[model samples]
Target chain A: MRLATFRGRDDESHVRRVGLVLGQGDHVRVHPFDAGFDLVELLAESAEWRDSQADVAAAGDGLALDEILLLPPVYPVAMRDFLTFEAHVDGMERGHGSPGVPDAWYDAPVFLFMAPHAVTGPYDDVAMPPDTERLDFELEVAAIVVRDVSDVTPQEARSAIGGYCVMNDWSARDVQGKEMSLKLGPSKGKDFATTIGPWVVTPDELEDCRDADGFLDLKMSVKVNGVEVGTDRSGNMGWSFEQLVSHASRASWVKAGEVLASGTCSTGSLAESWGRNGSLTPPPLQVGDVVEMTIERLGTIRNTVGPREESVAPVAPARRRSRLEASA
Target chain B: MRLATFRGRDDESHVRRVGLVLGQGDHVRVHPFDAGFDLVELLAESAEWRDSQADVAAAGDGLALDEILLLPPVYPVAMRDFLTFEAHVDGMERGHGSPGVPDAWYDAPVFLFMAPHAVTGPYDDVAMPPDTERLDFELEVAAIVVRDVSDVTPQEARSAIGGYCVMNDWSARDVQGKEMSLKLGPSKGKDFATTIGPWVVTPDELEDCRDADGFLDLKMSVKVNGVEVGTDRSGNMGWSFEQLVSHASRASWVKAGEVLASGTCSTGSLAESWGRNGSLTPPPLQVGDVVEMTIERLGTIRNTVGPREESVAPVAPARRRSRLEASA
Candidate 1:
């Protein structure tokens, strides 16, 4: 079952829905739920929830998956992403024509929280901040937690995983690389925005396929403005999702909606491989450049890059006073 | 206004009256909202909420602050604490007998969300995890976000703050320091459990003292088994709460109800300074250790560490068919 969050046209409110692709593959059915409702709560009450999802997939009669917008599957309580891939690290260094990788890069995985508000529908225009000239995309898989887990073993970790989703761990490479060297991480860089999903596929649907090597499957690609910059298998990770989950779950508790993304895969995206200081000089996504990312068995998400409009809506003086007094 | 979450004995819940200490002494009064309802939501809604709190305080007839049990005030979306005090960091290093701080230590303030499930009420019998050999306390102040903020300037940052509270960012020091070098952060070590209480004081009650020093001039002390370990001031910080909020709000959206803690103060508590391993070894809180933490102008919270006991209740087995289906 592929689940997604969409913004309704008239109301412009967020809704969670399950996508049912029709037999003709031309359309899909969207079953929406109330705001604040989550599948985790439903699953917690009874296993029937999973059975219903399967039943719906079997009875599919609906719209094309591409017609709808996609928001990140997990409304994460906490979003912790780690940079554990050495290949991507080396590729980044080599791409910059640098001397070598930083010595500390190999010791531990560098991680950071993707800013929570950067969430957008899969089809929403990816806003390119004026300060960030270089924007890149990385096709990766994200792990979703189904239940509260603490100090989980590798095997326990695998069972705790709710499902997988295709994630475009969007990047401002110039901002990331420069600030990361300070040893803090991409606090302001990759955190600015991260994109995920056209859909999230449940684990049972991909039975026996979540192996370490299978996870690193090399069949993913990133295309920017019709140019392919990164292509790699999923198995390229130094650590599997299970290991990452196991390591992350030690002592600390992880709630149902957390997202743990695999760092960029080797040559996974072109913008990161070619971006320069505050410049998206190569493979840059312009106002009309449609960025398309796809993973095998999971589908493709297409997003357009455009100038950021002043969405800081105008505030009338009276309304401002009222708001101030109300919150004051 | 001092707000509290308490489970009254009559099987009745009250979000009504909470205790507050004023110039004359302690008094109890009804907050303008029902008990058990999230206090953070109320704080975020009205600045006048604090004004109403003052009204409640003024009308207080003869109540006392020490007579009630206290629970963590705000419901946190995410709790990110920073080790920003140079002295506290140095003391931690000294406790570990380490030569110098790791490179990542200078990294951005490392933070982790302590499990919300671990929260206990003030005056409530605190329980220790059987496996933990060390339990420690940290004396600090926490800032609550009153409004939604993103990419805010420092000046705007100060306005985003809703209120403040006393927090004991408890730690299993050994576990934390061991894993921190691995670059993950004080995940297991510092956040296994966290205790915060006895009440929250809104910003209206806290006069602006930033002109004197970037600190909260709260006099605080900690005691174990009625023995004084250390004392410190809240204003002694490497970065002020305003700075932390500003840095955190940059490109990072902080929602109402979110909490940011100013790690521990220098010599503020035994766990942060003088204790072995920065924590009392055999860190178990015995049945009689009366732990008291006080913040000048705020109040003091007294909690007694108690022995663990079994309290498991019987559960009816699920219907047979349901069990069979689950097994299947």
Candidate 2:
């Protein structure tokens, strides 16, 4: 079953797609196509409808795909992304002088949640933040946690996933590279924009996509304009889907429709190969960059990165609290 | 007016401390906290005449202060926390073996949001995640954004803050230290648990807290088993509250009562100071390690860090997608 949220005249409309899910078609599920209802409230109210394949199939298609705008499917109760890739690790390590991480990284997965506004539709224009000049993109797989989970087992992780979508874990290369050096964490570089969807493909239909290695056999690629910059075999990821979910749900809880994204895939971005010289010159996205990314089962997501009209200098530091000194 | 969310049987109950304006009794203006009920709705629907303040006037009164749980004041539509301390930047840079970040470091502030589940009450047990054996606490200030802002000026940033609270930004020291070496942004380290509250002090009441340095004068300290392990002056922060708010709200739309935490204050935690050296050994939180933190105007928050529990390892990573690869 395919589920989506699109924009209509009054508000976002929720709809179901009839054919193979694609970006344009997916947007219609939420908007302009106007299934004539609120998807967020409806999804929360109709638990049985979400579970039944027949009920999902019966939801009408209001219009053809091209005429609509796409919103991130799964207006996630929250979104958590994990660091499960090796290349991204290597690149960051080389930037910092610290010793390398234990190979056990493959043994354990790391995850964090991005803000809800950080969620943008596949074709939406990502704003180049005013404070950042080194913005980059990360290609990854995003899965929606379908149910509430606590202390989940590997098997349970598999079942917890409701569906899958394409994620462009957009990054602030400069800010992230700088702050991550502290061995403390990445707070600024990542929180900006995290993009997902076209459509959410439920697990039942995605089972066949898994390959012999027990990982998905998706072929992933990213391009600037029409030039290919990166490519990778999804099977190269150090950890499996089940492990990420289980690790994320350990002690803590994961809620229904919460989106989890896999960190950078191998060769996920040009900065991994070409843009590492510390120069902010990989490319400034203009109105016509037409940057596009594609994963085998998921359809292509193409967007034109536009420039921000007015950017401001950073404001002065906050007022210092003086009374603490006397108390101390 | 002081606003807060307390844990009730069904959901977090919203309450407005009444005498806060009168400066007389410890009276609290209580109301049902509902996400569905906006501030206007809550104010309009409020019918409860009032609640007594006599129970809360005295400090360390276990009955009133300890029993009433505290959640991050606003159930934010969105949240963004920034890393703006020069001390943290220098320490992280040293760890990475990299040069100082460009003037951009002084020019802009970086931030990420606490997860939706991160909203914790004052007395609730902050779970020590099992993934990383090294858990640490950071004492900082967090304020909620009360206005919708885009390209806001520094002056606007000041006006935008609805209220302030004590923020305990929890960290997985080991995960963060290790991941930063790779130069990847913080994914796992800070995502887990970030606790805020006791209560939110409105911007009007905190007018004098901001000193000439343009930062708060809050004296912050963390004690484990009654021994002082960390201390800092909020005045040491490189970015002021206004700068942080301006940076966070630049392009993104910030909402009313949305919480934003200062990344970490100077010497905020053992992990940032001595965890790498193995000199900072936090006595394991036995069934009764009373961990408490305090900020001048905001108030003190006390929670007993309980004993660690055994847990299973996280599940495998999620299955990859073919469409993702194909699109790439």
Candidate 3:
């Protein structure tokens, strides 16, 4: 089952409704649930509830997919993205003139908390952040948590994922590098906007794509302005999704409606591509450029780069002073 | 005005209600609003609404403070903690064997997104993360946003704050150091729990404490098991709260009920004190130790360190592979 959140295209009230995607391509339709149904709430219920919803969806004739505007399937309660692709880390490190991936990278699956409010819709226009000149997009996939779990093993963690979706972890390379130099975050650098959806494809729909080790053998690709820039197999990830989720829950709760994203895959962004190839063939994104990313079975999300708005300048640095002078 | 969220001491329903704190010390009382009143929603309203609520509060008989259990003043929509204290940063770098603060530290107010779900009540027990041996508490103050604002100047951003509260950003030093070695986050290290509030003190209530430049001249201190270990002036911060808020909203929205923390003040944490003194005099926190942090005018929050829960081991690293081999 592919689930989505959408509002009727011509509806002035702008109320969001959950739906089950039916058919495909131009003939696709959406079986709308009750006006008050929420995907996040539904995902938190028992498996029997989901099956009941699927039964209800099968009975409806539904509305044409083109009649509605798709929003992100779930407005996550919490968001974390992990760098599980070793090739992407290698390229990023080399790009910064470092030797290669840090030995610490192999110690455990590491992740950073992201601003859940930064999420935007599948077909939305991503505003170019005022501070960046090197705007980029990351092609990835994300798993939506089905229920709350903590201190769980990899096997237990796997059961916590309800579905998956294509994700674009937008980036501002210039801003990110400067901020990360302090060893804290890529906070504002990646928090301006993140695109997810077209729809969430439930795990049951991808059973055939899972390998013996539980890695997804799905093709992932990204195209900018009709040009294919990168492609990689999801199975290339250094750590499996279950392992990443398990690591994330080691000391903290992975709550229902939270999103755990697979950080940029190999060649998933222009920065990595430039590092690997040693040339910026296709330069950083400019306003009006279109970015479209897709993961097999999950779906595609396409967004256009919008204009950067005028922003206030950051405060000037305070004059240096001794501890005694500061305390005085 | 002082605002808080609380529930009746014996109320098994556990319904949270917003209230205004009246009186002080042993004579303190809380004027509870209607059952449906939410502090987050109230903050998002106009000043007139706040004044009207205060009027209603003034007319109530109220409940004894000891008869209610206090919760965090607000369950933040988002949380960001900024390292704005130069003294703390200097001590931290020196402790890590670096000469002093990094040059990039002066560029702008650097912050990391924290897990909002980790927040607990002022007097709650903080769970020691399973993966760490060094548990610490950071003494800080946080401003809760009153309204949604974007691309605002420092002056404009200042008005977006509704009130301030004491914050304890709990940390796991061993885990944090290892994660920062990879330069992405202090994620799991600090996400287990954060404690905030006794109650939120409105800015108007602290006007007399403000210096000419708008920096708060408040005294902050921390104690462990009745032994005073750290003290610092809040005005020693290199970046003011307004500046931090402005920088945070450069290209993103700072919404109402979100929290912006003033990081750690000088000598706020055992780790910083150890860094400055070249000795772990008080040592890392033990499971039964009590931590009490106080900010002038804002109030105090006390938490006890609880035992760590057992967690699953992280997955072992996969065998090294070339990009071509992995992709194929």
Tell me how many clashing residue pairs each candidate has.
21, 77, 0
lDDT of 2 by residue, A169-265 (tens): 7777667666544433455566667788767676666678776655665788888888887787566676667667777666666777678887777
User: Quick one: best TM-score, which candidate?
Assistant: 3
DockQ winner among the candidates? 3
Model 2 interface CAPRI class = acceptable
Worst 10 residues of 3 chain A by lDDT: A318-327
Second chain TM-score for model 2: 0.75
Question: Over the stretch A105-209, how does candidate 1's per-residue lDDT look in tens digits?
Answer: 543344445555565556667777534666677777777777787767656777667667677777776666554433234544565567777666666667655
Instruction: Please write out the lDDT profile of model 1 over residues B165-249, one tens digit for every residue.
Output: 7777666555544444433354444544566666677766777644254456677777777777667766555566766766666
Candidates' C-alpha lDDT: 0.59, 0.61, 0.85
TM-score, model 1 to reference: 0.72
lDDT assessment of candidate 1: 0.59
Question: What residue pairs are clashing in model 3?
Answer: none
**Model 3 Cα lDDT, one tens digit per residue, B1-328:** 8899999999999999899888877777899887798887776667788879878986988889778999989888789999888888898988887898899888888888888777899888887788788888899989999788887898998788888999999999988889887778787789889999999988888889987678877999999998888899888877778888888888787888789999998889988877877887569999999999999998888999988777788676853457448576
Whichever of 2 and 3 has more TM-score, that candidate is 3
For every model in order, what is the iRMS?
A: 14.0, 4.7, 2.1
Q: Poorest 10 consecutive residues of model 2 chain A by lDDT? A: A16-25
